[model samples]
Target: MNNAGRDTRQSTRFMLLYALAAAGGATAYVPFLTVLLPVRVADLAGAQDIAWLAYVAFFGAIASSLSNIGFGWLSDITGNRRGWIACGMVLSCALLLCVTQVQDLTGLIAVIVVWQLCLNMMLAPLTAWAGDCVPDRQKGLLGGLLSFSPALGALAGVVVTHPGMASDDVRLMLVAAMVVGCVSPVLIMGAPRRFPELNQPSAIDQTPRKARDWAALTPAIRMWIARLLMQISEAALFAYLYFWFRSISPGFGDNDVARVFGLVLLVSVPFSLLCGRWVDRHNRPNLPLVVGAALSAVGLLTMAAAQDLVLAIAGYVLFGIASAIFLALHSAQTLRVLPRPEHRGRDLGIFNLTNTVPSLIMPGLTLAMVPLFGFSGLFVLLTALAVVAGLLLVALPRPK
Candidate 1:
């Protein structure tokens, strides 16, 4: 292979391994948040399950939001990504084991808070590490590779929730073990050191730019807003999906919903990968992001209008595919917008607010909307948000 071909192969290998690490890290605790935590809350709280779940989610979100930024900043200062990632993986794994011992809502909440902290300590640095190493041209391909993260997250849920698992403690241990297994490769091999220039922002021009000079910053800001809007829609729908499905179709149980969700994620994997490849090959990354948002709007509208399970499932499939593409692609594109490579970790941490802030807002949004206009109202609101999300991207100036 020529040097270019060799470099491409190396990038592909790194991205795939990185994606696997991301998937494993995600699988470790995401299932717990989406599935097991609720069950545990119900088990511990009885009639107060709903309220306790809210509390846990509220605290967990706060922990996640703060830790993501804090740890990312810490990584920036230390100029080390792998060490933080490795330490975080180990810490989170140990904490996951500690969770198995928590017998009450308070104890569980405490453990989850600590788990969120450790998880982000790993995740934020990992995200910044990508920006440090991956060239801009390969970002779309990287995003496509990242499509596996969600699939792995959903699959983790399915595996841990299996009837054969039988014991909650055993399931928790398995989740931690899987985290270790998945993250081991990246930790052991480590990422290439970031270019020294990427860690020295002071050497670059620090003067405020005129309007003409603002071109580079505009897309990044728009992308941030775009992601925030889309995530709000996703968070609302995801948190309430089970209840919404139950209300629409009484026969559908937790397992049924899980299966549907997992299938949707699985189906989306190829489409997302294809979209990423297309974006990279065509050099039209922004267009697919816009399309993904528009598709999400259509899906939300379909669900809002539908009164039956079939229609709802169809809507979910569309929305799932769109969300998968949008998130994966957006992630890759984000690396393009950072103004200062030296502050990549901190900047990415700030960008992650789009991910975490929505969690804080969605619960309240759901509470307010569901009572006033029901799921239909919520979907309609989400549809509008998706539309706006797409439109915001239109304002992004084309790459020079």
Candidate 2:
């Protein structure tokens, strides 16, 4: 092929790669909101003891974090990200399908925990794949593509099919998983090979090469910490957003709440892509992150104090825009800081801990705070988390 032809083909391939990664990521995240899904299921079934739902959610969180670390390390050793990614995607489908057979809460929680564990194996590696091969200049666009997660999750939230309707969640879950899972491997199959020799590097090395590698890796590490904190705030607020809203505005129903999340997500998509593209163009990842955090804090504080549903919904929109920007920029920014060309999977795995850790911590924190200060107290705590996350980014050494 001519040079121009070659360039066109390469651009096409990268676009495919971005789509596959985004699709697979959406599948992984779609099931994560199952906590909310089950709540609807329970309400439809006329079951009570709502607290069990939280337990199931916590179990899933722990499993997800553990799997992220394990599968990530495994991908590092194998130098084959697709193998594990495909496995996790398939396994999550099976577990999600099995969940349909459960009639009791124990069965429900058990299947969910297993499904979540398998699910993370797909997620941690899939996300790492982008960092493994994509150039730094494209990180922003990668973030923009990632906005598909919430969009997909929101769509999944509205189910014409439930368990009573022949297990709609499973049907959608399997279809989405298969499509995304199959595409993931095909897109990355031609990714430029790196670290042909898969030997483990010593974490103990003190050589200049090792030091340089460590320094290069700090941006990802610091961003991971920031993600963890931001997620803590986000998770805490989401975990109890309804309760908080109910206490302040008891009349709000499912339709109203759905509208709130929907509008917020709608406003967020463009903002997410815009921040990412701007950051890529300017090479200014940290600035967006700092601004996003501050904006999110203001929104959270507004939600905490608002008495009118309109104000709360407005707050949610602001929070969603900021959160979207934060999520996109942080992911792309981490790619810029990865140290080793060969071990992107390993480092990105560690980096994903920020995403998973808060899912585990936020629930407990939310529950503990409820009795002490109630819903209002949760927002104050969320603001603190956001502020700290912003401060951490500010403290990071300038990216080279």
Candidate 3:
């Protein structure tokens, strides 16, 4: 094979490793946040104080948002990605293990805040590192690979929380170990430094241009908005998913929910991979993204209309698959739309707001909506949000 082919192969391998590492990092905390933390909080604060789960989520979201932006900017300024990831992973692992020791609400909150910061330190830079290295054409494949992260996260939750697990501390330790093990490949191999076309000037160079230059950014901005709206729906559901399941079927347990979630994610993986490949081959990401959003809306509406456990699970599956496709495709497309290569890290950080901000708002949104209208109302709102997200994508100008 030619040099270009070899580089492409190598880059593909690197991105695969990076994607897995990202998944590992996510596994460490996502389950903890979505599944374990709520249970732990309820256990410590009393089942009646379940509202504290929202507070903890809010705190963690704020910390993660700020830290993600800060660390992304710092990586750009220092011109280093690997070091930040390594350092952050180490600190995150140590802190995660410490979480099992927290005995009170205040202590738990403190640990979550710090843990969020540490996790973002790794995540932000890791995302930036992708823009720094991956060629635009391959972003779709990368995004497809990224879909595995959430699946792995859900599976990790199942593993750690399984009834046969040793102890909470030991479970925590296992999560920490997974984080280290997953990230070790990227760190050990070192960040890829030679993508010949990796940061070449596109139409939207840092230099000033006319209205058209600004217009060029609209696609990325639209995708950002789309992801934000869809994520709001996702965050609302994820935060309350456990409770929702319990309310729907009091007989079901955490393991049952995890199994359903994991199955949905696993089903999404191959579909996401195929969607990514289609996006890459066709150079038409918008169609898939918009379709995914629409699918999510359908899923939300399904959930809103469901009156039984089987129906609820079906709705979740639809929503989960749609979310997986949209997120993976949108992520792959992000690298293509960034306006400034010189500040790719910072720009990507800004884009990440779409991810973190939803978490911040979802808690408040859920509390306000659920009390007034119940889960049905919440799902209806989410359905509308998903539809709007798709519409925004439709508004974007077609790629040149």
Model 3 TM-score relative to the real fold? 0.95
Off by over 4 Å in 1: 8-10, 190-216
Measure candidate 1: CA RMSD. 2.3
Off by over 4 Å in 2: 1-13, 31-36, 40-50, 159-218, 246-256
| Worst window of 10 by summed lDDT in candidate 2 | 193-202
lDDT of 3 by residue, 212-247 (tens): 666767777787888899999888877888899898
TM-score of 2: 0.83
Give one clash count per candidate, in the order shown: 0, 0, 0
**Model 1 per-residue lDDT tens digits across residues 1-400:** 5975655433555677788998886787667776777777778889777667767877888998899999999999998889899999989888887876888888888988998999999999988888777766678788888888887887887877876764888888888888888888887875553345444564445656565347557778899999999999877666667678988998876667767777877787888889988887888888989999999999999999889999999998999889888998899888887877777888898899898888788878877888799899899999999999999997776554
**lDDT, candidate 2, at 326:** 86
lDDT of 2 at 167: 50
All candidates in order of TM-score, best leading = 3, 1, 2
